[model samples]
Target: MGKALDNVYKHQSLAYKYFLYLISVALIVFFFPKGGKFKYEFQKGKPWQYENLYAPIDFSIKKSQEEIAQEQLSIRNSKTDYYTFDGSIVTTVKNDVQKGLEQWFATNTFTARQQRDALKIGMDVIDNIYSLGVFENHPGSNSIIVVRNNEAVPVAPSDFLDLESAKRRVSAELSHSAIENRIGLESVIQTSLRINLFYDEALTESALEQELSRISYTRGEVSQGRLIIAKGEVVEAENFKILNSLKEEYESELWRGNNYYYIILGYTILVALVLIMLFLFLKRYRNEIFKNNNKVTFIFFNILLMVLATTLMVKNNESYVYGVPLCILPLVLKNFFDARLGLFVHVLTVLILGFVVPNSFEYIFLQTIAGIVTILTASELYKRANLFISVGQITLIYIIGYFAFHAIHEGNLENIEWILFGVFVLNGLLTLFAQPLIYMFEKLFGLISDVSLLELSDTNSKLLKELSDKAPGTFHHSLQVANLAEAAANEIGANAMLVRVGALYHDVGKMEKPTFFTENQVTNVNPHDDLPPRESAKIIIDHVIQGIEIARRNNLPDRIIDFIRTHHGTTLVYYFYKKQQEMEAEVDENDFRYPGPIPFSKETAILMMSDAVEAASKSLKNPTFLVIDEFVEKIVKGQMQANQFLNANITLKEIEMVKKVLKQKLTNIYHLRVEYPE
Candidate 1:
């Protein structure tokens, strides 16, 4: 048991990698829909590509969403409007009209017979208005169903009297009356009339909903063994509907009982395969990232994020699936890593999403093309304008790709969904968040990107300004080395920005004792002359060590610190060491050497070569092109022989390229112009 535990502890990293793979696969598969996938692909106005298909079992042909919506709308338009008739209101209005007419007659000098006739006429008008059913307001329907005495009866809207119509009726009836002061009697009747018909919103809505529910979502049925479509047949409107119904039914019925577990297993295997491909890709091509668990986690986490987002969108509403900023994946990865890895991971993510999204072929094609555009166009993420243009281009590609697919499916440009264009534009805008997200990832995962590198490369920064003030000559030397290193890195297709930033801070340790170095010696008094050779060597070698401490104090990223540690790479301080050897019989070499882990990447290796050649080129007297060439070649070749770049992932060919860049840059610095003879 102890041996087993020890073995587990020894291989913990390997076990952790497998655990990441397992968890990623589990999460992706868990989010995937449990429905079985249909084997056949079909589209309206396109030829069926598969063999002849027949119904395997009896299934009802379900109506399309458009058809169902049309049916529901028709039901709404043809629904019966319901209104409740208040008989009690009519009786109350009659009594109020009688009392109003009697009071008016009492106030004026009217004969008893005249008062009796006026009260009878006013009550008659009120009764007539109420019989026609005075409405509170127009119901906005030509016909209505009136509920009275617990029975609903059809009634014409014209039969109901609104306030204006009721007033008109009262005026017309009073004008024919023989009673004196007919206008007074008419006013009393109008004042007493009230609305007796009220719209029943609840009843109307319930009735409409009932009618809509009765709509037949399934128009017909296809029997078992019926031929649905033949190979190479054009999928017309009817054929497309039938095929979709069959697909829906088949997928829904396929995953039942034990088949559910099999579907889950199938999903697991496919997810595992895709993840395995990603792992193999990292292991083979991006071994550095594969070795680092944090980097691996970052990559997988991005994939999982996109998958979760896409699955949620599809589940809630598939129409808005394009609104998700999937292209952000490649953009973020390219900024943090390289374009190749970014594009590769983007393709794998889109492919995984294709398994769940509708129209797998079109989805995969559109996303894959968008990923390519993201990688190809997005450069210098630190620059806001570059990212904006790339996102615009990416959005335009989505629009065009979707347009083309739409045109193909419908066989024309008509009926194209214009809302999806807005979604694509929104997608582009969301992609701009990749910059901030990259900053967050850097903080969370302890990684660096070009954006941060650009910030670090600024000479006006606090640390860099301090370095320039304290060690002006060393700062200028670092500038020259930066230019040379940047040019070399660009020529060899390495990270030029990273190398330039590293070059800027490589000699920051010299700021501690600036005058001890010759470049900072303004006068001919050498400070090293007063100190012993061994002590001088110690001072010189301590710069690399001091730079690291200073960097840590300033919170510089580890990537930048790597350059400071490896710039000297254990090379001996030859001037001090040789002087000591002449004085003593023997001297220890280790005391004169700089502590180093050496350069381990292309950027660090370029900085080492650039630093050594730029510092040495200062010693040349009246240099020419040939002298500079031999000088640069000798320095780089010596470093190569001493195995300065043995651990770095660099080649001899690249080393020669770096030497050439140094020679040319030095020549240019000294103004080596060609002479034209007359």
Candidate 2:
């Protein structure tokens, strides 16, 4: 039944996941409203309100003709019942007819070309008709005047100003001007004239002054009968709809800016829940490694890491920022799995969030950098007081992400500064906040979290301090193994620090029977010295199982427990197995072996290799470079022949590298060479 259920769960189609994702996106788009506008209103020397207000005119214009037209309209609309119109007449006149008897000067001019050039300027001036609008009687009252028939032809309204006097004044002004010689009218007829009218304030005030002096003929009294048109064109029926809607749309957009904020809020909640669900799923399979109460703590801390990662991915626009989230999952997983699985998780999360966030290649780069840095920095974070390392990791993230953002956006230093401030704040605050948030989430979801690592490494952690006091020899051995394994792993490009940390805790189970283990004894007297060979072998082989049980009893991480289980591959206990075989010459080799599932992971493989090499190197008689090299080769080769290296993903090339590094390190540790006398 369990197998059937597993098959059913595993075979669920990819199409289902994609369909759910599509539905999620569609819901976000549909629910997030995007039509809102806002306008700024100024009143009483203060911005009274930012409201939904509409303006009829757009005063900003780029075209010269449009600018000129607007300005002309402003002037024309400054008054009412009076219009100033400009019309042009195109005309031709006989050349040289008016320039008569200058007998002494003109007849002696040069060639036709010279004559044409000189004559051109005169004809150009004479060929144009010009009009002007003027305030005739008052500031607000304007009249149009055209110079025609050697007179100012008054185009002012007949009832307003005294035209005779106005015309005389205009004629007198024009007669002595430089343009007077160029004034010649062939034929004058008005074309189209567009007129704008508005109530002139000055005119109204003047009329009040001249209330009694107002010469009213056919038109009614100025104060009583005149229309009060606005200072600008009023918003009328024809164009009102377009302007009103435009204003409303802008208003809606501005006021509804919160829509995006809500989207982010929704995104946050959704992501957190997703991470929590993932944690829970992993927890259900927790029994696969070992049972523990700290599953809630483990899940909580990982979720916190994921949340920090998601926060890093948040951007101003909805462009993809996949790397932050992608990088995060692998880091959390690496704490629980092998490095290869960690990398796979990282890549998978990147691809998944890339689809979810709809980001570009830049998202991948930032996430990848963050993932790599986090993996490197936090690999040893299982140690004491290393939470600050996450902050340092975020700083690296800031630098890398800053350059990546700049590269993607084609930005420079100034953009870099803002990006640094933004991404740094995001990283730091999220990282800091992740701790508490994970705690809270664990409580809420009833989940396990890795945040316990911080507490587990505390100076006062009962188990660690107890191990140090009660089994100092075992404790010292653990430290040595940690160092060796770390070096070896680093040389092979695996997560060296992580391997070392796991090694430190791998033998914690030995604390249960400190006297039984050789390292925990002060003297070199073996406890197994008085026991039968099979009985000694049984006790020796059972330490791994005991260590695994102790790790679970104390709620240690699965990763640490894995090292305890697999660090000693199923090889023969040479001392015990050899003695038993000689005692009973027909003894089966298989019966003398360890309860054997060998190292199946790189970390465990590293631990096993390092543990054997470290212990064996100490027993070398008269240790020398040649002697150490010989021993290193023999041990590594022996493990290989026994197929102990089979399951650990250690490549032959990597094994060679590991051997070289181990030999070098062991030589230094043992002081294999004598120094020359100074």
Candidate 3:
């Protein structure tokens, strides 16, 4: 068990650990909630009640009881007693009938008391008319009609047809109607006073005129509370205005606050926070792998790409459609990491991003399947120029994924055609255009990109040119080392470009003192030939530090500089150390070693192994494929046993694969073969 655990740790690298940490951060942010819930309710009534003044009321009156006992019962069955009067007289006659009539006329006609009593009665009639349903009540105005001697007179609204006005109008009506007995015609005349009753509210002049034209019974004239008529009669207006007013009141009540304003604001904040959290987590995770250089710009580009995808997803989510083409990301990762780890992480990222997007389960499943296919297809195939072939290959995977997804879901084939066509276009775009798009985005936003691996392939890089000019043999050796490193990285499904780049610059310090390095010794004379073995060891050991300084001075990337500094792995300078021991010289083993923290990352580890293997293989006089195989296996195994690759993420199986690939590459570089009979 201990051995097994040790083996596991042996294969782990810092790069891999940082990669996992990034994923963990993404998971943490995706689940954070940003909004709280609240209960909502709507009320049904106004805060205040209004009185309805136009309610219906009966206006009929009944006969009085004294009339029925008098024996001359003419009128009956009135709803009100005041509506009828009895017809009998109890007074005795005078000796001359004309003299008696003259005397009765003198007693009642034109007298101050009699006129006052008549005017009082007219005013009472006007008040009663207003109380009847004929007149409607307005909140601020009341209506009345004026009459004088049974005739309605024209008057201004301000002129109340008070008792005086009523008497004048009634007397004028009586003169016009020519009624002989005032008492006998009182009931008939009062009926005339009730001529045309309508809404008796005091309206504006124009409104009053308009309303007056609509009434057909009596001519309406303006008075204190009513219209005066030529005849003393009133009619009631129909009531419905109360309900109309009530409906208007209710409508106003309903137009109060909607509460949706607060709801919208709350929802906006919640959605924004959730989206921001998602972006923050993803950006942080990417930063763990990419470090902080150009971080915001890289994050901006990724977010823009994600936003575009999210927009498409939202537009098509309802249709169960997703538009991200094949597993281009997995190919990218595999081109950048171990095939197995790349596949696992790519699938995870796809699943998580699917949730972030508004896509259905079908999209998630299809993307996973397509991503697996692309990664598997490109796993161990690491020719940088051939990266595009993986795109076409992924396109085929996309077609299969799209059709299979729709077919399983029982979607209509005809409707699926447009989506399939769109998928094709998206595939072409992601494959052929992703790099250019990333490059453009980098320029626009000042982003640094991981997409352009081939830039590391520049043979005319400053360090390479420096090596070529100062130490031609070392330059040639660096090229061979690059070939071996690239092959090993390809075999393990790692970044061949990164490995190749590192290999090309690893021994750059040897250029500073070309004679001290065996590879650059052109005159068959070694600088160590004159120097003591300990001094020669110190020179070799210092070269790693010198290389690092030179690399930093030129502002090379950390990735390239790391390879230059760590490619030696603190191993003892065996030749120099052994010679010192033969001379019985006491020296510290550390003093005869190259100073190194070891190859801490997969790219650096691969660089160191390939450099050692390629340089050591050159000593064989008659190198064969088997000889090259043994040499590579020995170099890799020695490094593994010495714990040089202890913390690196390169797995045991991957190490074996690297060894096999290195052997093949070295055989090719050396043209190793058995000389056959010909």
Candidate 4:
């Protein structure tokens, strides 16, 4: 039991990594839609690639979205408009007419016969206008449905009378009348005429909506066991619709009861496999990052962020999926890591997204290609112009690739969605945010990127300026080391900017006692000469520790501090050690050694080589090309023999290449031309 506990404690980091992988998988799978994926892949105007297919079960053939929209629009345009006939108004107007006629008759001096005739004419006109139904306003449609007696009756516009038409009718009626007081009768009839018909907005909208709802989403049905399509059959528009209907029905039914768990299991397995592949990639090629749980978490978190963003966009609206800026993943990863890893992670992310986004093939193709373009073009992310150009190129690829796919699917550019171009442009614009995001990640995750390295490499920065002020000699030495290391890094295809920044600050601890270092010693003052060999060695070695304190105080990133820690590795201070050895029979080697975890990265390893060679080169007298080459070889080869580079991931060939760059640079510095054989 104790052994088991010990084993668990020893491998806790490994266990934690597994837990992270599981959690990432769970979170990704959870965000994925719970629907089962359709089994077959088909596209309009393309030949079906699968085996012969038949309808497994009966399902209504769903209409295309465009077809449904067209049907709805037609219903809205041609549907019957509803109007309410206010019968109460007709009754009130008629009563008012009768009373007005009585009052007029009482005031008039006409005979009772004339008054009766006028009243009859006035009532007749009112009846005529009300019979046709007076409208308050003209209906938009030529025909309207008037609701009367709790029943809708279709009426034509000409069949109804507005106030103007009602007046005209009243005038005609009175003119034909033999009443002596024709003008007075006309006035009474006109006053009695009131609009009883009104447009029923609520009823009209409700009726139109009902008609629209009645539109059949499914145009027809396919029976079970019907041969849908044979292998190599062209998936035309009609066939595409039927296939889509089957896909929807199949997936919907597949997600129903016991199958739901199975679907989730399937998704979990897929997502787990993808994440595992990423894990394997990091473990194989980027084991240092894999060991560092924080970096591992940062990578996984970025992937999750992109996936979550894309999933939300897809759920909100599939049409905006392109606007999610998936290529930003590659850009950010490339800035923090390398292009190969960035492209690999981007491809894995896109594959995971394929399970959720529409048009899996098209989406994967476009995004994978865009990621490649981003890695290829966005090489110099520190430069804003380069990033802008890269984003433009990525956008252009998206547009062209999408256009090609669209053209292939539809067999014409006529049906291409031009709005997606705007979406692509939006995607490009959002990709520009990768720089700020990289900066934020650097702060949050305690990671370093090229942009930060670029900022750090500036000589005028606060810490570097202080480095120059107090330890001008050491600062100049650092500059030489930086130039040498940067050239070596570029030759070896390592991170040149990172190595340059590391070289620039590698000896910052020398500032604490600058004169102790030979490069900073001036006026023939030898501080070390006054002390014992052991004390002198301690002072020299203390510089690394002091530099780390200074860097920490100034808030330098751990990555830069790595250079201060590992520039000398654990190699002994040979000068002080030899001096003490001459006096004593034996001396403790640890007392004269720099406390170091050693260079554990290519950049740090290159800095160690560059720092050693540049400092040693200053001791050379009348340096020549061959002499400088031999000197560089001795220094680097001595360090190699001491196993200083064992922890770094650099190869012997790369080391040789770095040596070549260092030798060439030293030769140029000394202005030494190649020797000629006479």
Best by TM-score: 1
Off by over 4 Å in 1: 1-10, 107-114, 174-181, 530-532, 583-587, 673-678
Error of 3 at 44 (Å): 38
Candidate 2 global Cα RMSD: 22.5
Candidate 3 lDDT over residue span 1-678, tens digit each: 999888777655534444544543443333322212212111111111232123132111211223223322221111111111111110111112223334445665566655444444444444443322121122123333333334443333454333334434545554543324655334323333322223323333434445434433322222232211212122121111222223333333433477444544544454445444544554464433444434433433343344345445554553423455435545544443345545655555554454344223556676677667676666333343455676666667667777665554443444466666575657656655554554565456443335443565577866677779999989898898888888788777676777787788888888779888878877877768899888999899888988998877876667677888889897888899999899876778987988887887777888888888878876988788777778878888888887898767768888878777787777777766667899
Worst-scoring 10-residue span by lDDT in model 4: 115-124
Model 1 worst lDDT run, 10 consecutive residues:
123-132
Model 3 earns a TM-score of 0.48
* Two-way lDDT contest, 1 vs 3, winner: 1
For model 4, what is the alpha-carbon lDDT of residue 326? 90
lDDT of 3: 0.55
Candidate 2 residues 1-678, lDDT tens each? Answer: 999988867754433444443444344333333433223221111222333333433321122333445655554554233233323221212223234312212645445554453345433433322233323343334543333444544455542333233334334444544532223311101111111122345545453445423322221112322222223434343223333334444444544556766655555465445544443444464332222324433433443444344534443344323224334455445555445445544654554354233323556666666666666666543443465676566666756676656654443444344544565555554554434554564455444345554444453577777778878877777778888888888888886655776777877777767887767777778788798888877777777888888878877766667788887788888988888877887876666576757887677888887888887766777888888888989988998999997877779998888889888888888866667799
TM-score for predicted model 1 compared with the true structure:
0.95
| Cα lDDT, model 2, residue 68 | 48
Better structure of 2 and 4 per lDDT: 4
TM-score of each: 0.95, 0.47, 0.48, 0.92
Alpha-carbon RMSD to native, per candidate: 2.2, 22.5, 25.3, 2.8
Candidate 2 stretches with Cα past 4 Å from truth are: 1-432, 435-460, 523-525, 674-678
